[model samples]
Target: MIETKQTMMNLPGPKAKAIVERDQRVLAPCAGRVYPLVIDHAQGCEVWDVDGNRFLDLAAGIAVLAAGHSHPRLVAAMQAQVTRFTHFAGTDFYSESMVQVAEALVASMPATHEWQIFLTNSGTEAVELCLKLARHATGRQNIIGFFGAFHGRSYGSLSVTASKPLQREGYFPLLPGTTHSFYPTCHRCPINLSYPDCQIACIDLIERVLFQTTTPARDVAAIIVEPIQGEGGYIVPPPGAMQRLRDICDRHGILLILDEVQSGIGRTGKMWAFEHEQIVPDIVASAKGLGGGMPIGAVLARAELTRPWRPGAHGSTYSGNGMACAAALATLDLVQESLMANAAQMGPRLMDGLHALQHRYPQIGFVRGRGLMIGVELIEPETGAPARALANAVMQAAFQRGLLILTCGVSSIRFCPPLIITAAEIDEALHLFEQSLQACL
Candidate 1:
């Protein structure tokens, strides 16, 4: 059965329930809620829960599995690496795997001679490392971040992430000198100005904050952006929004940091999502799909950006283990081939299907984003305030129907299927999505 509730309850999913119960009782409450299906094993888009019920996973582990789960390439590469050494003292002894991965990254980066690389384990660590690079490069302290953007959950990245209050709750006295400005959300803009015609009020606000306002350019270390704000409803900035930010950063001598942790490595139909814009960031944070399904993060920058960072600037044990590097190298090859092409082709199909659905349902206020990184925004038909409740209902319904989807922003549902998804799979996911939205309505 491809996702029936009866099948959902039949397999090891029930036995896994015991593990969840024990985890909740003994483990930390901060673990948060999870959908009932327990993933037993997966291949392609189909994952069988403990109950032996198969479901289509559209979420793809929060955009980490762009090449799909347990692909033969990744398996073969990782299996080969398993016989080799895994970790080494990264700072003390450099591994050939990380060195080779860095070489590949530099080759993929924009035609620039200054692409230096640093390896980390996760997206959060990548951003954390990004901050250090900017600080060490510019000798500045303050940081300017866009509202509703999610960088990561660590202290440095979390402080910049202007999402829910709980994400920042109890983590008070966050990285100081960080300021939030209006995000370039074309739909339901905070500034209430029309896009393209308004000349991007969000970008204008950044100018106001830095040059005209109290945020002196001298103290600012870097300007961080998501290119396509992943968690912030997949909001795409206006045509010139990115270049404007680039100009502002250049005028002020501030480093431009792109958090491609979720958007990079072919997730957005490009090797780097920022390539859509002609501008180049001083430092880029990348993770998620960089290591295939395994965890790996990296800070890609110009050679000059890391000049000030000394030998011990940053160090981590698993920065680029043999397995992670092998998997990442294999992933890079896999994505640079067919998966990216599929994402470019399939993302628009899904978006068009969603837009058609939005025409039928007023609850879907707006839809925006690029490539496979798409979001359907929820809005109250009358008041126009964020329809968080509606978003939750749609997400829950989609999960129940065996299509794994995720929610984001104050009122939005994000769709980041694996780049390897086929046209038929995208259509099928949209079919389930339409049913979920109807039920939600």
Candidate 2:
């Protein structure tokens, strides 16, 4: 495994503690601070805390660093672009980098049909734009989202998000005409039904119950979903689930929107998680790893659907900022070159190790994911209930052991290390994780 100082230092060292003290005074309360990890710098999958403590970053800034931290290519591209010019009002004016970024995004999409892109500053913006476009194109008012799905935090995107009650608490009366349906989670089925044998009834209910009783299919503009639910837990829907959704959308003329914010950019082996189902989405929302840590989001939609919008219909000042575009181009190049394939190759290695750990640790109720975007759900051994506190404790314990991990859903530990992570690093992470588990126990 990767070598490191064998002894673990006292966490939140003097320097980190001081920074935390200052941050607590100035930073907003909403800024969720999980562990006291004051980062000084990072390279690849390794991070150095402010007090010189080292850490293996399995979270990757919530899976935004597809090319790892401070990748030379990304740094070079950003430096070169900033020196040339950073922002030129991309929506009002033209920039070659902006055009090239859009071109690259279109080319990366499925070749079955022509595609177009609308660049934004984050995945939330992309989702907001996608929702707007869906309504505009279909002349419909209603949208369908899955339960336990997170689209974004913006007013429009947040309307469809239901990952946590806390996220939507106090901010009520989200965008009108938005309804939530049950996501096909086989591990703990919402309807208490088995998979395959259940015939994917969760999706069918949208038509049989939802459309007929509440939001009519004729008025529903779109059905937005995450191929692999991220915050709701790294829950991967069973096979044929996506195809069933696609078929429903086709029959009802509802647009299919895939929120690839976390699962896109080769995190799930494929360039986009929806590809795993061999189905195409009308619009795809991407961000997170797209810019290799730089802030950039995009809405890739069928060309014909976006034609209704006039010149000044929808736009953003930083829609295609030169620096962001350059970073995106460089990041996409790295992902396409080998990182994508590397994720596909290394994913099995990591998952196999996790499975072995599950066999030994009964608390690991379920392990599911694709590529490097994996999650291990912790449950009580006797009751089989979600061990939410145990997951949090394990995450904190891992941090103390020089490993950075995060919890998602109710009791799942998400592992989304940078795509550039090596086999040795995975082993090291697993070892640290098991140690943390034992300590927590």
Candidate 3:
């Protein structure tokens, strides 16, 4: 049995310091970096920095590696494909691996809907594809998105992204016909109303106010949403929220687009997060974990909606490259085999542990998530105000204690470990997290 070494040498050791200095000088200033630890290698749910320091990784590269880092199966598949062929401009040409991946993804859908796929290179591209298709198919210009939701950084997606003002501060004159509405965040209700009595006022506001006064439903092309909001916090809406959106779309002829970049691909212990709500979206944007560690994204839509997008309507050079397809095929196989089931079994266990910590520490204002995608919100112990500083301190302290975690939303620590994380690893992470919280206090 392989036992993990839960300790690290002083962070930014000699080797890491050299690299960090060089990176700061050369890399773009737009990249948001959390910590200074430089990774040298990783396996399963653990990572080591350049100084031979080992730490338990719970971030999973921002929830990208569902199969974990350096999995033999994925590495072997990618290596084999590299030797055979690398890129062939999949948009214009064809490759067996690319076709096979599309077929597998179609089969992984929730139900039998005549679906077609358009491959891209990242989640943002997937969102861009869906945005363009919605406008093209519906022949409408307006789009609606949630206030605390993040789709991507591209022009069309960024226009709908309202998670942080910083992401859109400098960029001006975004896509013209985009508007934002409140999401059903039950923990901190956006409309200042309770769930059972509120009757989903957020969804109602779209039709009652926004449609009637500003953006008419007739001109709206689509409503893009995240099944579980990612960067805005791992916030899951109350039940029936999605159904209500689907009903609204049905009445308005608006395409319901689900941006599952962070919540899909077995991260929620299911093939797709929307399946939990039992709602079939008109289009689903996927990425992050789709290619294990490799970069890949795709847009899945019903045949009717996609039919309008004729050939050459949209194309990219690296759309479904051979290497990415190979890695994705191996990732899908592993996710289907046993990793997904393991995530299903382990999710509640992790949440329960987090709940216990919350009980012990009142500073932990809330705990919520589905499957491996979890969040613990931090607040001031006395006033219950959002403690953004406290959250950052806990994250840094956790790193010192050989734990790798991250912060999301305004003041929440998001725990998105690799889906292959073991039970023991989960327990260790919780223990380290609690210790960090105590240190911060």
Candidate 3 residue pairs in clash (backbone atoms < 3 Å) = none
lDDT of each: 0.84, 0.94, 0.91
Per-residue lDDT of 363-415 in model 2, one digit per residue for the tens? Answer: 99999999999999999999999999999999988988899999999999999
> lDDT, candidate 2, residue 392?
99
Clashes of 3: 0
Q: What is the lDDT of candidate 1?
A: 0.84
Q: List, residue by residue over 1-441, the lDDT tens digit for candidate 1.
A: 223332222323566677677767787787566466667899888787766666778888899997899999999989988988776766678788889889989988988556989888899999998887788888899898988889989899998999778889888999988888887877776778887778886787777755568787778889999898888778888788889999988888999999998888987788888899988888999999998788888999989877767777678888877788988999998898888888888889999999998898888888887889998889999987789988988877777777788898878889888888887788778888888788777
Candidate 1 local Cα displacement, residue 359, angstroms: 2.1
Angstrom error at residue 428, model 1: 1.3
- Where model 1 places Cα greater than 4 Å from the true spot, the runs are 1-13
TM-score of each: 0.95, 0.99, 0.98
- Give the candidate number with the greatest TM-score: 2
Candidate 1 TM-score versus the reference: 0.95
Weakest ten-residue segment in model 3 by summed lDDT? 1-10
Clashing pairs in 2: none
Model 3 accuracy (lDDT, Cα): 0.91
